[model samples]
Target: MKILNIYRSEPDATTKKLVEIVTRDRESVEFDLNVDAPDYDKLVDEIFAADKTICWW
Candidate 1:
């Protein structure tokens, strides 16, 4: 099964780690901003950008 990596907090920092995993698997990586602010599309775009989509928070 494919794994979708999502960082519930500090997406920018987690993005770096996502890159490493993507490089190894040659898969797509997504990013979402979660900090009490409300932005649904922003969140969706992040998940859709990746091959596998998931929510950790």
Candidate 2:
């Protein structure tokens, strides 16, 4: 299951650890972008490419 996780700034320690464990051998990706300089085009492309998306503010 291709999954995409988007977050502004660094993710919490727990979330980081969980993602590391869960994404092993899995098609899961994460993007950490600046809120002011977000790459809308690339983000849209990833959104379409992924089967599911999770965003954190």
Candidate 3:
């Protein structure tokens, strides 16, 4: 399944580790404020495409 991980800020070590684990078998996408925030309109499309979301703010 598709998983969307939204970070309000840059990801920490734990966040990075989690992404690594989760993406091992399925698709995992991350949207971080430091990078993706400026392109929220495009990110929203991605968000909607995901089957699940993990929001870390």
TM-score, candidate number 1: 0.38
User: Can you write out model 2's per-residue Cα lDDT over 1-57, one digit (the tens) per residue?
Assistant: 898988876888977876777677779887878567788899999999999887766
Q: Count the backbone clashes (under 3 Å) in each candidate.
A: 0, 0, 0
Q: What lDDT does candidate 3 reach at residue 41?
A: 88
lDDT by residue for model 3 (1-57), tens: 999888877788987888788778998887776663268787889888999888876
lDDT for model 2, please.
0.81
TM-score of 2: 0.74
In terms of lDDT, model 3 sits at 0.81
User: Which stretches of model 3 miss by more than 4 angstroms?
Assistant: 35-37
Q: How do the residues 1-57 of candidate 1 rate in per-residue lDDT, one tens digit apiece?
A: 344555576645566665565657556444444557657686676566666665544
Taking every candidate in turn, the Cα RMSD to the unseen true structure, in Å, is 4.8, 1.8, 2.2
Point out the worst 10-residue segment of candidate 3 by lDDT.
Answer: 29-38
TM-score order of candidates, best first? 2, 3, 1
Candidate 2 regions exceeding 4 Å error are none
- lDDT score for candidate 1 against the true structure: 0.57
